[model samples]
Target: MKRSVIPREFFCRYTPEVASDLVGCRLVRVIRGRRISGIVVETEAYRGPKDPASHAYRGKTSRNGVMFGPPGHAYVYFTMGMHFCLNVTTEPTGTPGAVLLRAIEPEEGIAVMVKNRGPIAVDRLASGPGNLTKALGIGKELDGEDLVMSDRIFLEHGRMAREIGTSPRVGVSAGRSTRWRFFERGNRFVSRGRPSSPQNP
Candidate 1:
């Protein structure tokens, strides 16, 4: 079951579109010849500079400049001054849009993931953005890495989710009105299992 890497064109769409479509895709990280991967189960979209919850909403800066570049790049950022969160840049070049990879269902390198996130239930290993990044060894050094071509990390095409759920994004002080969070219906790995109305991208 060798999956093909998802192409850059897949991420060139609107951030919400990319976020919704990203469910069930594979998020992979390669370290020292070992591959750790998971099925993307949750995502939150941050629309361009207008979306106040987005880091780019305030316009590009030294930290968020990568998000304004071409789509299909990694947008890793340190949050809460302690943990890292991973996002994928989206939209046309110069547009500041991205999809936060909120959660994933572990598929490979379970041993490594367990090592990073010790003594946790398997499904809980990557149940949140910070947890997922820690399990997959993603950090600030991976910021701006091109996902379309990076050998260390990249997305792979996986089975599309037959059912998807949508709801307002979690943990955002602003842009709470935007129902841009998406997750695989009934996926236990999702950070928040509660489902609202389904959205069609």
Candidate 2:
């Protein structure tokens, strides 16, 4: 069976509603003659300008302008003096929203990922957003790339062997009321930084 490249083709239908479903999916990178795969374990949703924590909250600028573009685009950004994070642009052409890829568990090309992240263990090579981006060689140059068609970075489907967990996002003082972080339930690779929801995390 030729599965669609984007397992969640209609992912934009609900804005941040189903961003959690992205957990457990695989993100593939074909870089420099090597193919690497990572199992998505953590994610966060940025709900348009109204949400204070969103980068697009201040309106579209050259930095976040891509988020205003159509869905399926990569709206990656750099932060904390030296870290790059990946986000899947969401909503319509004029809406600025996205789902943040917080962490992943490397499955393929582990050696390459380790090389990128330095002598880290295969399991901890891409445990957090910064760590994962570092392990994947994802940087500002790859910003604005289209997730649906990018040869360097893309996503795949799998029968995730765990439950989908829910929680509030981490590292943001604002928009704390909205529970926008999601992860693979019981997955050891999941981020431990976020606060768990009463229902689950």
Candidate 3:
């Protein structure tokens, strides 16, 4: 498949707006000579210091400094000491904000994803953040990488999601009342099933 990368300016918008708009867009990863791709299906927004659920809420640190960098960069981070999750920086430089790429519908390189995840059902190949990263071979090494120009991984233009659902973010202890999670409604590949509300036409 051809890759038409999204430009840097696209991510300079508000975190939640970017997160909602990301659904159905293509995330591509080029590993060696192979191409692995998927359609983004679910995302959660983090709005810098004011949002308690955000890693940058407490303030910037060596681990989270990337969140303060310019938009359109990868913010891959380790979670639970066992899994990696992928996020894209949002807003502008000096302001920390991001969108967590929660789920994806695998589009290419199924064999590699299956090999990495081991005999999982096809629908669940990249159904969650950790799983998505594993499927695409994304890890800490790609942290702070520019997604707009990175040869390893980048986002491409895909059809915008027509029906979008919003809800309180999952797996976060704080900011539980904030409806920052966005996903494609009725998409079986979405990371979670319950939609607290509907947003976008």
Model 3: per-residue Cα lDDT over 35-132, one tens digit each: 89988999999987789999999999999999999999999999998899999999989999999999998888999999989998989999989889
**TM values, all candidates:** 0.93, 0.91, 0.93
Q: Against the true structure, what is every candidate's RMSD?
A: 3.1, 2.4, 2.8
Whichever of 2 and 3 has more lDDT, that candidate is 3
User: Which residue window of length 10 is worst by lDDT in model 3?
Assistant: 192-201
Segments in model 2 whose C-alpha atoms lie over 4 Å from true places = 1-3, 194-201
Clashes of each: 0, 0, 0
Ten residues in a row with the worst lDDT in model 2? 192-201
Across 1-201, the per-residue lDDT of candidate 1 in tens digits comes to 755999899999988999999998999999998999999999999976678898887787899998889999999989988889999999899888999999999999999999999988998999989999999999889999999889999999877797988888888889978889998888888885334533333
Model 1 lDDT at residue 102: 93
- Model 3, residue 16: displacement in angstroms? 0.1
